[model samples]
Target: MIYAQILAGGKGTRMGNVPMPKQFLALADKPILIHTIEKFCLEPRFDAILVVCPADWLSHTQDLITKYVTDSRVKVVAGGSERNATLMKGIRYLQETFGRHADDVVVTHDAVRPFVTQRIISENIDAVLQHPAVDTVVPAIDTIVQGEADAISAIPVRSSMYQGQTPQSFNVKALVDAYATLTDEQKASLSDSCKICLLAGQPVTMVRGENLNFKITTPYDLRVASALIEKRA
Candidate 1:
């Protein structure tokens, strides 16, 4: 039961008062969400491609899919309050629709990240087979700084740090069971779903990602995406 979970729940606050979320914004000839979904649709291994978005925008997202996507694997559902919560919504949907299996894999991705390559997706899917969890990352090019209250708290070694990207794959049943064992405090501490697997003692493997595979958040990123698309054309 391979799945592609596209997380698209945000309100686009950082995108500076847009009429719609960043994922719905046009990137080249299509909406960013459409572009992202199309990438997964190309990979036929996925049994389902779940597009989880804000409840308020559910119909809007569904309409976009109907108009732009020809693939029957794509299904839109309202997302939860937070990213991980949205993921749980997807996981539960998979459970109800298909039931859970220990080896059943789910490759989770950010809907705003339209540039994620097929290589990244394929790597994540392959990594999840041997490990309970997989995270897509690129070697950090800039020195990472940990700060607190306008002051540098710590500076991490650049060589050891990696920037996380999406298409984080996991054994669906393993993640569901591991998530259940977490305490309230542990849940709150999680920055991403892979952390739940880590906190609960499940091993997470890392896959190399491309630098251009970025999440389009700000106007600058949108501009970059547009240019990239034009170049592709």
Candidate 2:
């Protein structure tokens, strides 16, 4: 069975004055995480969803689920301190509850990326089915330049550059095994979950992503997201 794991453990340090985590904050009449969860829940291909949140936010997250989702297949579990740790915890739970032999297609996504459309989700799922080593990423659109300190150093071609985003879909066993091998230093430097699979010498295939799926990290991001939602609505 395909499972969607939403990582919602961020402390919203960048989004100053947002009383709650960015994911839990209201956007377009609902919590941002709920919008993300609802997108996957609407897809029949996803059998279940696992949301990883900080331990202290468990009850609040549960309340949001009860209000918005109401799907019995949804599970809210306490998350770990770091992003990778929280993801590992969610993977362990999926393995124990659903059994390791289950179809093993796992999609790990950022809870704050509420605008990820169903088309993107389906495209990534299809790619994973065909390519054993595949990840959903969007190419860098603007010109690329490398800078050092306060000056431009090099102008690298943007043709081959892409910014990574989630939901990074992978075979459950493949991802679990890759993450299991991460060392303390490796985990510390890991910025995204897909990197874990790549560090294991796995090639990641890219799928186009919506610009609106950008993560809400700061006040400006929240403003942009809110504007996008308003524009779409």
Candidate 3:
């Protein structure tokens, strides 16, 4: 069975002191997370869709699901301490609830990114059939500068760089096995889940993502998203 793990455990630190988490903020008529969940709800490939949020917002998220989504496949879950831990929590839930299998897939996405396209989702589903892991990315348009404390460390080649997006799908058993191999130090430092597969000698396939499929992390992003949503309508 396939699962959709929508991570909504953020505290909105980057959105300049918002009243609520950015995921709960309005995007037109509905919450940002509801729009994100709606995208996956229409996908017939998924057996379960888990909306993982902070423990404090569990019932609130469930209420949002009840009010906004009409499907039974979607359910709200509480997330762990950090991003990766939250992801693992969702994976563990799937394992314990659905029974784990080597071939089962979990498509993990950010709650803020409501514009993930059907094509990107379909490609990830297709690619994960062959590859143990798959990640969504769009080629970087600007020159990437790797710096440390106001000093330039390295200027990477622009053509080779890509900005990562979500729907980072993985084989359930493979991800669980890879995650187990991490040291506490290694696990603490990780921000990307695809790197977990790599640390276990797994090859990650890449699926192209669109620029419009951006994560709404700031007020500027919210404005852009609002405009884009209006335009799309």
Candidate 3, residues 79-168, lDDT tens digits: the string is 999999999999888888889777899899999999998898888888887889999999999999999999999999999999999989
Candidates' TM-scores?
0.97, 0.93, 0.98
**How much is 24 displaced in model 1, in angstroms?**
0.4
Q: Can you write out model 2's per-residue Cα lDDT over 89-186, one digit (the tens) per residue?
A: 99889988988863578778899988888998888788877654466677889888889998999987899888778878888777777877888788
| lDDT (tens digit, per residue) of candidate 1 on 1-233 | 78999999988888987899899999988899999999999997899999999999999999999999999999989999898999999889988998867679899999999999888998888888888899999999989999999999999989999999898999988998899999999988888888999999988899999989998989998999999999999
Candidate 1 lands at a TM-score of 0.97
Candidate 2 local distance difference test against the native: 0.85
Estimate every model's Cα lDDT from 0 to 1.
0.91, 0.85, 0.91
Clashing residue pairs found in predicted model 3: none
- Measured with C-alpha atoms, the lDDT of residue 189 in candidate 2 is 89
Judged by lDDT against the true structure, how good is candidate 1?
0.91
Model with the higher TM-score, candidate 1 or 2: 1
